[model samples]
Target chain A: MPKYLLIMRGTDESNAAMMAGIDEMIATTRQFIDEMVKAGVLLAAEGLDDPRQGVVVDFSAETPVVTDGPYGETKELFGGFFMLDVASKQEAVEWAKRVPVARGAKIEIRRVPGSDEVPQA
Target chain B: MGTVDVEAVWRIESARIVAALTRFTGDFCLAEDAAQEAVAEALVSWPVTAPVNPGGWLMATARRRAIDAIRRSVALRDRYPLLTADTPPASEPDPDRIDDDLLALMFISCHPVLSPESRVALTLRVVGGLSSEEIARALLVSVPTVQARITRGKKTIAAARIPFELPVADERRERVGGVLTVLYVIFTEGSTATSGDRLVRPGVAYEAIRLARTLAALLPDEPEVHGLLALCELTAARFPARTGPDGSPVLLEDQDRRLWDVSAVRRGLAALARASTRGLGPYGLQAMIAATHAAASSVETTDWERIVVLYEALGRVAPSPVVDLNRAVAVAMATGPERALAIVDELTVSGRLAGSHLVPTVRGELLARLGRRPEARAELELAARLCTNRRERSVLLQKAAGLG
Candidate 1:
């Protein structure tokens, strides 16, 4: 079973929509999670704290330049992620299609590389 | 040799053999299945032709089984080419790797990737050398459920690439907590079933004790491990008298003191002494509480004040609504029902334990002691309605009816 990380990114509009019906959003998300759990594909899922509580540390400068919260020019902010055990990237995307996020939000599916895949010395 | 002797030998050696195989193959499920195959072979051949070195024979047999399995499965061969690179060994597994292998096996069995239930089932199956049926009986789950959990647990560990080795010192501290929690949950389930017809399942409880002993041996300097062992020993010492002839629950106050296991009490005291070398952890504190209960000849003579103090410390260290409810019970014993009732009411107002039957049950007892009959009856009835365990529910109902 290859584990896939489903990263949820939210736009400003999506964030506003999420805040409007937070309870219903949470209920819908819980139902989708329950479905995945029953199917035995869901490994872990957790929502990130609000974007305002986050920080970005850019190391492109000689010394790292630390910026607080979301960047002023930010369009899509990574909001949360779910780790699922599935066969392929397509299967991972199939599961991601069920996420109950607002319309403007986007999900990026990526496989989590296992420790065994690392080149040994 | 008798079946008991064979089982005893297998239990003692299974973890070491499987651990070594897993390290060699880097496949947990294959190692466990090979170990099982070797044990099955032992059952057939051991009685007919007893080997001089039984443990070594089992190891070699299991190694061969692993090779045979890899050869049989194309998927496994492609995935674990390293395992099939060499021919099966004729000699025993390397003795030098036994200790580290055992420790790594413990870590792997209790890896954080698996759910708590999965960890318990896998640990008992691999480390404790229990069959799926035995685990199902111990946990009161269906055999299929246990099998599914074990399979999924192994798949999850392999999928997550959880390494088969002891973690670094800093990481070990956090990881060991998860291991200890699994052991504690197993002991608790065995001591007092969460929801079952029986109050105590000796087999499960005894298995937890055995696993704890192995863990304590492997990690001798860890105080919390010894603390957990001491707690299990002290609590299990009272198991002999925890039920009546008809198998009904015998409350601590009502139990016959003569039936207590004196040897277990002595062992618990020794382990507690070792745990006290450092400051008491949560398990150490709980062991102290159990030791206090064991020391008293009767419930009236039990040091309720000390228990109350212990619960206070426990509340600070491991704060939970259950702890508060327990502290209220201790207050009732140490002081008066009036003081206890006040504490219970405060807990109710906080709403931390709103839906649990324990809150109402304790409230009912305190109210009954304070001569508030109607309120006590209602509370006890509510507890009865909420309880799921048939025996416990019947007792609550009896108490409610008696209040009227």
Candidate 2:
């Protein structure tokens, strides 16, 4: 079976500086998506809402509290996501190499959890 | 009737037929010489028969002639298993087999071993089937220049002992990029001539476009090839509107969109769709950027912000000063002229584009937009002086005059 999702985050500071311009960021992302699709590796890809629009829900307590914008102290945040079907971790890694990320943005690769074991919102 | 005329016609058809004959005979020089001899025969016989299948006839005669030559030469007596064993296979080979030959020939003609000038000359000679004089006229260069480039290009290929066969898949990807780049460069030069008396060289541009389209068809699965074809089609669409009645350069903003070639645009869009299927690489990304402009009805309606983004992506994939300059232009249109000017200022200060007319021309535009007429006028004048293209220089002068 092919690995479905390879989660990635911007890992380098230089890459972060490169993304200073939003127009350039979007253009690069779209191009990456276009290439992935043509290669038959891309199922779907999307850039997330701005960090300010992101809402993190905490379910650790009885009552879940939601916080917005720069929600946590984690240096690496999910800026965008892509769902791909590739042969192995190596193939997924190869695709990751082509992503247009900021110089220092971290790309964390993780397998998508099955529905039964999905992380709760 | 003249020797050069015969040589010219032979050059046009030689590469393709030679490639096909090579596959048949499995001898490179023999295939080449036999093809040359067949052309000589055609020079005498064509005037009389003028056969419908000249290429086919040449292939047939060349195969037979190659066998005859090999038989007469003592040096090749031991290696005559394939040629002497059989009555040469029918000259009219399957089209599928010939496609491979043509593809290999195209790759060879546009090989990276040759310089850009040499690549273009060889491509025109071998693929576009153009004579040296024709290429000379089309490029506005001396015939001797074209002749010398082709001579050196062929000699280099021979010296390198480059196999005249289609590369394997892995190697194809790497090598194909060079071929595509050469064609793209040719099309760009013809479309917006770097330094020339005329604004456009339709013949050269058309030939490049034709070759690109052929390559795209030959390799349908290669996204970059389709992307290149899309870029050519989209860019060529504007040729009709890129100049005025007196052949003066028409700024993109002032061009009449209605005059654009709609069919070419449509074809470009279709090719872009194919390109998109494979995911955009540098050429595909650039084509997508061009498609953004082609999609808009007018300059104001163009998605400059998207273009800026595409250029940035292109920069990452293919880092070049030219891409950065273009991205800056897009930034100016998307954000503010001031921001664009700042970027241009940095680029200039860094000496990345020190002598390029683009730096001053872009700076002048931004300055003009910011209401700095005097500064803008001076920059435009500087740009005009730096520019060697008559059409572009005239446009810069007009902008300067308007500023005053």
Candidate 3:
């Protein structure tokens, strides 16, 4: 089976809205996770720390340059991701569509190549 | 079965058996050891009493051995209820799920969590059915090192709780790239020794080719897999003419093209066609460059301009200092030495390739073309000193001497 990653992105307004109802959000996400787990498709799921707490290590120069805090542009922030071992990209999309998210949130689905997909001797 | 037949069967089926056992036992290291024990038993008994289905027999034996090990282990006592010594009547693993097991083995062996060297060693051991000593000789590492890498690789996968199953579709693409990179690393080291007396280890290169052909056969739909296979095949075709009979390095321009392997070149071109149909990836682009060289009657007639364009595209997708240096060499052929030298000088100032001999070697050739004999000789001498291969060092020294 191939793997797909569901990248959940949220705008500042949507993130604030979700955080405001944190208890309800956690319950809703847990219920969703439980569904996937019961289906035996979910491999891993993780949510990110606040964007402001992150750092970027730029390697454009001779020495790596480390910068602190949120990225320069903050139109959309990566909120979390789910890795699912599904049969195909379509199936992954179906799973992503069921994710609980507020308005202005987006889930981008990407196919992960499996060992069977890799060429070998 | 004859000894040779037994060896061949073991080589082909070892990975499948180990993978199946791993899935059953939920322990990678134990599964591998059980599989090894089965192969050892096969070597001892197969010649004496050949089985109708060697793969099935091996799988049954391995599965039985796994149960025995689990049953004996104090740590595994809690899982004894889950274990079974019932070797199925059929020798084969469940037909429907065997392919998945093999695929899982590939991913586990080439897991990105392990170091690249560890990946190569472990993959060769578990996937390719090679012994530690064979792997040691192939990669020019000691036997203990090969063993250690394999051991650590298995432990790492187990400790990290890496699943013994194929990844989801989204991660499979990245996983494929990771596996290809491991194969490429092995092939590259085989083709050009990074720090060895000899310029090449033909055995390792051939081993890599074998592994690549297996990959291509199994995953015919993956374009980059074919791309990597094409690259390795075409590059290896030139091996026969790459060195002199006395073991001195033969520069490409001076090597006898007639000695190149025609059959390998044909296979490479066929693989390249497959890659092109799906749109060329980075390895495909590199294979195209090799194809250009292979198709040319001589170095002067090779399409340097096309090579430069491919390199530019390659840079956009997979930018690296080595690619830039290679592009500069192609540029020298397409344009002039002065233009190429400027590019090389820029790379020099960037200091990305400060320790590599390739920079000085290319600079020396460009300087020679520009009639700067003194500077060319000096650069060639420096390259000679930096070179690790005795054969290549001699060739570099010869170039420096000819400048006088």
- TM-score on alpha carbons, each prediction: 0.73, 0.71, 0.73
- Model 2 interface Cα RMSD in Å: 22.0
Q: Which of the predicted structures, 2 or 3, would earn the higher TM-score when compared with the native?
A: 3
Candidate 1: residue B72 lDDT (0-100): 87
The candidates' interface RMSDs, in order, read 21.9, 22.0, 18.0
In candidate 1 the C-alpha lDDT for residue B19 amounts to 85
Q: In DockQ, how does model 1 score against the reference complex?
A: 0.01
- lDDT digits (tens) for residues B1-404 of candidate 3: 13335555655566767877887788888999998898889878977887866777888888889889988998877766776645442444354476567667878889989988889998888877777877898888899998889888888987898888887999999998988988898898889987677887766776667667666755779999899989998998888788777777787888788878776788799989998897899999999999999999788989899999999999888999999999999999999899999999999899999878889999999999999999999999999898887788888999999999
Per-residue lDDT value at A33 in model 2: 76
Off by over 4 Å in 2: A1-121, B1-15, B25-37, B64-81, B84-92
User: Which is superior by lDDT, 1 or 3?
Assistant: 1
Query: Which of the numbered candidates is closest to the native, going by highest TM-score?
Result: 3
lDDT digits (tens) for residues B94-117 of candidate 2:
656766887887888888788889
